[model samples]
Target chain A: MLERVRIVLVNTSLPANIGAAARAMKTMGLAQMVLVAPKIFPSPEADTLSSGATDILAQARVVSSLDEAIAGCRLVIGTSARSRHIPWPLLNPRAAAAQAWAELPVGEVALVFGREDRGLTNDELHKCHYHVHIPTNPDFSSLNLAAAVQVLAYEMRMRSLEDDQVEAPFWGVDWDIDAAPAEDIERLFVHLEQVLVKVDFLDPENPRQLMTRLRRLFLRSRLDTVELNVLRGFLTAIEKSSKQ
Target chain B: MLERVRIVLVNTSLPANIGAAARAMKTMGLAQMVLVAPKIFPSPEADTLSSGATDILAQARVVSSLDEAIAGCRLVIGTSARSRHIPWPLLNPRAAAAQAWAELPVGEVALVFGREDRGLTNDELHKCHYHVHIPTNPDFSSLNLAAAVQVLAYEMRMRSLEDDQVEAPFWGVDWDIDAAPAEDIERLFVHLEQVLVKVDFLDPENPRQLMTRLRRLFLRSRLDTVELNVLRGFLTAIEKSSKQ
Candidate 1:
């Protein structure tokens, strides 16, 4: 499954970043790499930048377009630094990696990295099933292209190993049942937030961090279908009773 | 809590690696990086490699010894790839990030990364309360120092984001109990290992992974002081019954 993971670099500006990305991929045991219309490749700069992992750079396929880069991939994910005006389906790097690896047994998965100056265009992102956001500091969020690849590659590689049991995040709440799908969770959040605002518990004008914290708390709970439904039903009752 | 997490680099050889590491740190929102006797600093190579993260390089403190680098930190973790002759408490990068963040409220925490050639020495590892091993390819386990930092720094910073709620790991046992101190946990491991060996449950001659897995399980449980004592008491009883 890990071997089926392809790291695609689109219109990369720096040759060194291309080399570094190859090195990062090799170190994590990923072999497949594809480049789409890079400014310069097959250069000494890339070889020097590859450190000891130049073989990955050598085997890397150079394509003319992003479509060709991900033509055979069953799962296509683009790395995006900024949010769009209308949000697309987004996955944090961890989730995206998990989702990609889960699809790997069926077919190839492409993790697309955009150009250095600007990330993937909206049209390019629209082609992807998900956008992976590598959470960075708001103040200095200009993550080097290879550094971003290093993170996602590391996550994907780690998931293949049994060590993920140790790296799991602390969700605070544990559910014995299967977790609800992301769409169901989103619907629950919207339903609950609407009721809270209706009951004056949340201020729509100046919501501040109430909704954010509530999202964190509920997300941390990892609610199952029954639990989510129960919570939503309780919120509805509160909305009706509060009118009295 | 973010401000309290310190990044300590031990005896780095390459100036470029340091610069790359500084850039990696800044991108992940980590500000504090302490170097213990670096070979070169303030070099043009480091400056060039830092790519726009030179401010972090300018502010990084170079210390004479590892002890001095982490003097004020109450929690110290070292990054190691291979197992020592006798294993120390260890965590995968993700768990170490969560654990370090959890300790931030208590006091300053240190995340130590060693040289590109050789990782932390036994003496240096002794100063650390835990070791964080970033899983890499077994055939080519040689991870570049800056790349390793980027992975860990990314993990630590990502945990601070609200996305942790979705990526949380399973702790297995859930008890609303205070987590025991690292030192107390260390002591418990020592006491438990002695009894396990004395009772022949764990053979000292060929210890294998018995103790290593035990440490991982206990650490994952995040036992409190009372729980540690109760487990120790059970060990003592087992030893007594084995004698009979």
Candidate 2:
């Protein structure tokens, strides 16, 4: 079950921290690791820090972009530093782990971590279905990279260790049907943006925050594969009507 | 309430580990630290590793022994590696934090950690009224000293941040009364041991596990001050009856 969950590091700075993150993940029985444009990889520093868990580093997949990292993942949860601006479905680490576990049976799930210095960009954050914030001392919220991973990974491990109690269905009765993967969601957003611009509801000259808000609303609902197709068809009908 | 909680490290070998532990504690809103017979202190290495949490390292109280470190604490919880031989009331980190929170209002509480390499000594482990074990991958359970501190401290902080929903009382309706402090509990044990030896119930030549089992039973109950007095009186009565 844990094998299907991937830890995605986006633009991580220090190689040692990457190794440390791998070690943290391994300690919690998580093996899958995906590095998105890491500053350096396969470095001796990372190897040294990973200690005996070098197998995680050896097996870690390196990707050129976050898109490639979370490509087929149906549920992508980004780690965000507490920010009031990103009014998305924000969850604490424990709740996030529960959500991840709930989705794990459906398809691949990704727990995405940001750069060591600045966390996920607003654009990158928008790509995620949910954001998880590790609540820390407000005065000293500078959580070390691996520490954040450790906390989240620990929560994930805890969730896995729990008895096979029924997890509250994330999407009610329709949960058995797979949720649309990231790429499908991305295409939907792009098509929706184009239709909005054509209909003159959204200004092409000044997009403003309308698309972002729309994305949040849709992401929060987590469109299933069938729902995605229906939405796509609806958008195609709108285009046909506009052409007529 | 968090202010009343102290993190005690016994016989820590590295100054850097101490510093990292301080950082972890500070991140989780814990301020007090007690170091028992550390190999090094007031070192730049500790300060460097502490990052911006130097204030915690600066204010940390260095004591000569574990007894001195936990001196007046009402509750002492030791972090232990899973050992089947140590048959005592062991709690996972989350449960330990809840227990700590339940006791925090009564008096000071201590969370004790042993050396980085060997963890708490059997003698040191006996000093704690309760033990907390963080579950890890059994194959690679080499949790870093600071990481262990981070997990426990994080749990403590989470407990503190929770709404003041009444904690499940550790001692029923008598919860309003003060629980016996560590020193008082220690005294009760001493008196009981003496009386047991006098009655030949406990062989003084080889005490074996009798005292340990008794400690576990009494510690699990968490005697209130009044109960402590009652137990002490009962022990005295036993001694008098034995002498007659």
Candidate 3:
């Protein structure tokens, strides 16, 4: 089960964090590592920092884009700090592990981590099936990248060890049983936000947290592929009606 | 409740860790901080790391020993990843937070974190009523001292949000009970341990956890000054019996 899970790091600036993350992953018995456009790798610093878990770092696969990083994975979970911009399908680390690995019996899973300074771009985050938030002291919520990986990795390893396969309660009964990938959801957000602006229901300038709050409500509903289209269709209807 | 909880770091080697710990505590709405025999303090590095939490560092109390650090505290909980030598009454961060804050309604409480490398010594662990163990990947279980503080501090903040006191099990029976200060309690430990040693019930040389176990048992009783005196009187009676 652990073998099927991959750790994806996005635009990592520090070689030390890569090594530290590798060490953390190996300690949790997780070995698959994919780096998305890392600034440096195969460097002495990462080697020195990996301590005894240098094997994981040595085998880490570096990719140019997040899409390339999780190419084979059936499920991709992104670790986020609950960014102010928009809320996506969010789960605490434990629930996320449960959700991701429930598919472990089927195929590979990917856990994506962001850069040290700026986290994943909204466009990049749109690729994830879910976002895992580590409960942190909000004052110092910006945890070191390795620590964040360690937390999620630990939960993944623990979730694998437990014999019971308890699925998280479904968000809602919807037309689409298959959850839409991040791209569909992002498109819906774009279409809906645009329609809202066109209908004079929302101001494009000084947008505030209006879109963010709407994102939370929609994300909580876990909009499926069919559901996403339905929402976009409704937005189109609002645009047409407002034009008349 | 938040005011009564004090964070104590014993023999901290790094000033940056101290500053980072302060930042963590402040983010969680915790203010009381005590440093016991820190190797280097009043450090610019600490101020830099603390960022906006420098005021907490400026107002922090420095003490010579753990006893002085927790001088007036009625309860002391030491955060250790479970020292190899002995099994102390262990509570995970969540339970530790609940236990520590439960005393805030009456008297001060201390949360101690030891040197970054080794955690609390066995003797120091004995002084605490409970030990909080933050669960981490066992293979690379070493968490940065500040991160550990951040984890526990976060739990405390969350615990404070939960509105449930009626479910807490009662501690003891006493009237208008103001808990004895840590100084008085330390004195009582000294007197009782001495009397027990004299009575041959405890061997001071290689004492093991005889006194440590006794400390836990009494600490749990939430001894008020009168209760402390009564326990001392009972110990004195034993000393007299042995001499007779």
Return whichever of 1 and 3 wins on TM-score. Answer: 1
The residue-by-residue lDDT of candidate 1 on B140-183, one tens digit each, is: 67677999999999988878885454652323124355445444
Interface RMSD of each: 20.7, 27.1, 27.0
Best-matching candidate per lDDT = 2
True contacts kept of each: 0.31, 0.19, 0.05
Ranking by TM-score: 1, 2, 3
Cα lDDT for residue B63, candidate 1: 91
Better of 1 and 3 by lDDT: 1
Q: Candidate 3, residues A124-227: lDDT per residue as tens digits?
A: 66556566776665555656687677667766766765654222332333232554543455567788888878877788777766776665456556566677
Q: What is the lDDT of residue A244 in candidate 3?
A: 35
Model 2: how far residue B51 lies from native, Å? 1.5
Q: Residues A1-244, candidate 2: write the lDDT tens digits.
A: 8878899999999998898888888888889999999999989999988877899999999999887888666567799987745265677887788877875765677899999889998767766666788778899887888888889888888889887322221221235566454456667888998999888899988877677666645644656678999999999999999953
If scored against the real structure, what TM-score would every candidate get? 0.67, 0.66, 0.58
- CAPRI category for model 2: incorrect
| Tens digits of lDDT, candidate 3, B1-244 | 6756788999999998898788777766788889999999989999987757888899999989876776555456788774554454566666677766655665577889999788888656655655677655566675667767766776676678665322222333233655454345556778887887776777777887566555545544546777888887887777777853
The residue ranges of model 3 lying beyond 4 angstroms of the native Cα positions read: A1-4, A23-30, A48-51, A83-86, A101-107, A135-140, A154-244, B1-4, B26-29, B101-107, B158-244
DockQ of every candidate structure: 0.12, 0.08, 0.03
Please give the ranking of all candidate structures by DockQ, highest first, separated by commas: 1, 2, 3
Q: Candidate 3 DockQ category? A: incorrect
